[model samples]
Target: MLKISSDQALQLVQQHWQITGEINDLPSYADRNFKISGAQGNFVFKIANPNWSYADLDIENAALLHLVHTCPDLALPKIMLAADGSHIIPLNLYDDAGNTLACHMRLLTFVSGQVYAEAAQQTNTDLASLEYSLGLAIGKLDRGLSDFQHPAMMREVDWSISQLPGLIDEIAHVEDAEIRALVQRHLHYFADNESQWRQTLPQAVIHNDANDYNVIVSTVEPDGDHAQQKNSNQASAHESDPVRAHYQVDAIIDFGDMCFHLRAVDLAITIVYALQHAVDISRVKQCITAILRAYQGVHPLSEPELRILPALINARLSQSVLMATRAFRKNPANTYILVSQIGVHRLLRQFEEIGADELEQLMLSAIR
Candidate 1:
């Protein structure tokens, strides 16, 4: 990951896209991101990781275009093409060690909202509606991507649920013996059932990672105006209305992990993150029911899909902990890598207590 200075980012945007804006550096796991505020409109300028090739970036752009056309109501980031009409541009960048590397650059329209993690803390936030809205958004996103395809969609991504078997070797990195055993049990279950899922489950290109930070939340008043509106009149109305705002998932970002997989895997990923916020098993069940019911309202789930949710959710949690463990090992100073690991051990235990058969029944009842 090469670092791009704010000055360099501003210069590159002006030189290539012919647009100028004040650059605000944004934190990213691998790539460099800058929020560009200009008179025209705000946008995100991205410098891709050196490992990303043109095909990888193009596939993502193509999918966004497809969704923009197919699902117009959804707030999705549109890829901003360069002056020459290319979505991707190759540029040579230098690291601190003075090594030159070729990387791709992109510009995208910025979609604004408070991140879900931050929004969940507000006093007036409606957790049930927020969970349902998240489910509906993912359902529509998966449906819009059903017909979309590209050669890169077949690429093997490390984060895909189907690749859980590969991470089994990395489980040893988890220091706690109890947590390591829980991860081991789930990985074994995933390996046995993955082949069957590949054969029977409906497949599609999925957003894949819908973690709290990747989702954007916005509040809509009963009068239909959004909280994002800057009108002083609207602000006063919201303050005086005595009505609670409805929290909805307005946008999903960070498609870097997008890949082709079981459509049910997308729902499983959603359930796992939603459960992360739960205080107990009862709340976990509530979150699962809310999401599954809302999702089925848009795209119905099959019996087999419902049955597999418990195992898949467990497998995803294991993947998250293992990946965070490995990344934390490499950069011990960055404790943020282990943030997602909080309460994961307890969540996994809750799942075990519920057991798979009873969990399947809960999902079955949810969709009914």
Candidate 2:
């Protein structure tokens, strides 16, 4: 990864866009991203990875612009046109060797809110409302993207669930024998069921990576009386209320992983991350049901979609664990990758013990 300094990013923004602001680096795996704050307001400045061609970025920008029209009420980042009146511009930068490198860059309006991963950590927060809102927002996103099409949406992506089987060899890289076998079991299960996984299932453009950090939720301030009542009803809130009473899904970020795929695969990816904090099977079921129940209200899931979820969810977990292991081995000092995989092993084991029959029944109960 080429390190684009904050100074270089600021200089690029000044030259390309009319707005100027202080720039700070944002975490990115394959691209350079920064948050710019100024009088005009905050915005995201992205320098594309050299791997991403102009056509690839054009497809993504097109989808974002399309969603603005299709789901106007949804809080999505709007693409900001550069001073040239183009949404994307080519820029040349020099690496450490002083060789010129070409990259495409763009500016976007920043979507505001607490990231779901951080917001979920607040002990006083209402998990039920947040979980349901997460599902509802994803459901609407898929619905809006249903009619959208692009040549690049079908590009092969390494992180996609459809690529789970291709990662089987990576399982050996898992240090723990038991964990390695567990990953193999799920990957094998996915291979066996590959024929049915996408058979007759609805396919469309989906925000495939709904990981906790990529989605943002807005927190609602509780009035004095509401706060008092919330304390009293904390226990029952988990069972009764399905409304967005405490928190609401404000934005879904990082369109880098968006692709054309099975719509249910999108929901399955959401379920995997939604259960990251679960300490037990009961809590897992609670989160799963809340998401399913809310999602069905917006876009109903077919019988086939519901049945394949356990496998897809497990496959995704397996993918995460395997990929994390490979990444950690290469960079032992990056503990964040290891930290992200904390509860995945436990969740995968729990799902294995629950088995497909009962898991399917549990999901059925949600929509019933």
Candidate 3:
């Protein structure tokens, strides 16, 4: 893979896209990303990974275009065209060995708002409120994708919930023996229940990667007058009452992992991330219930899907921990991959104590 330099990125943006701006590198798992700010507004410049085939990029671009037309209400990033009216631009670069490499690039209008992960860190916001809003957003996104289809959607990918059982070998990459054992337990559960889940759940085009970092939340300013009035109404309220920040789902980003999968899989992925930072089991249950209720409000989940969700959620967390462990071993210095490692461990331990049967009943009752 050819590493893109700052100078080359700026020149590519200015000369080819006709956009001039201060380009800053953005963190990414594989692809190179830069945010360009100019008078026209901010845009994201993405250089596709060399391993990505033309078919992969084609499906991602097509999905973005389809969303633009069918779901105008969504705050999805809009793809910008090059001077030649091409959605994707090809670039020639030389690697360290002095060999030329073919690289693909594209531009997208940057969506504004704080990423949910960052916002959650700064606010004492209600967990249920945030989960409810996120559920509705994912529900609407999946609904928009119901009629949309592409050949690439059927391609086998490691991130799919169906592929979780196959990742048992990756557990060896995890350094912690306890964590590895926990992952193995979840894998066994998934293998035991795989047949029933496959037969019962409805599959569809799902936004398979709605992790907190990919979901953006619009900022909300606190109202002093309302706060003062509420405090006065409650005599026990003290001056130390923390001002809570409210948030709404602004946009969903990162479609690289989108695919045709069980409809409940999307919910499971979202729930795993939502519960990542949670420490209290009761609070985790509350957040999960709120998310499911809000999602059912938009698109009701079937009983069997709800029953299978606990296993799916466990599998998703196991996948995250295993993948993060592998990435850390390969590039130990990459902090981005390790961001959720601790939180995932905590969540898995808590889930084990709570038990899958009990959790499934809680989730099913939430929608009922």
Off by over 4 Å in 2: 1-7, 221-245, 332-336
Winning model by TM-score:
1
Those runs of model 1 whose alpha carbons end farther than 4 Å from true positions after fitting are 1-3, 222-245, 333-336
All candidates in order of lDDT, best leading: 1, 2, 3
Per-residue alpha-carbon lDDT of candidate 3 for residues 93-181, written as tens digits (9 for 90 to 100): 66778887787899999998988887666646644456667777888787777778998889876788777777777888777788789
lDDT, candidate 2, at 271: 89
Model 1: lDDT equals 0.82
Worst 10 residues of 3 by lDDT: 230-239
User: Which candidate, 1 or 3, would have the higher lDDT against the true structure?
Assistant: 1
Q: CA lDDT of 306 in candidate 1?
A: 89
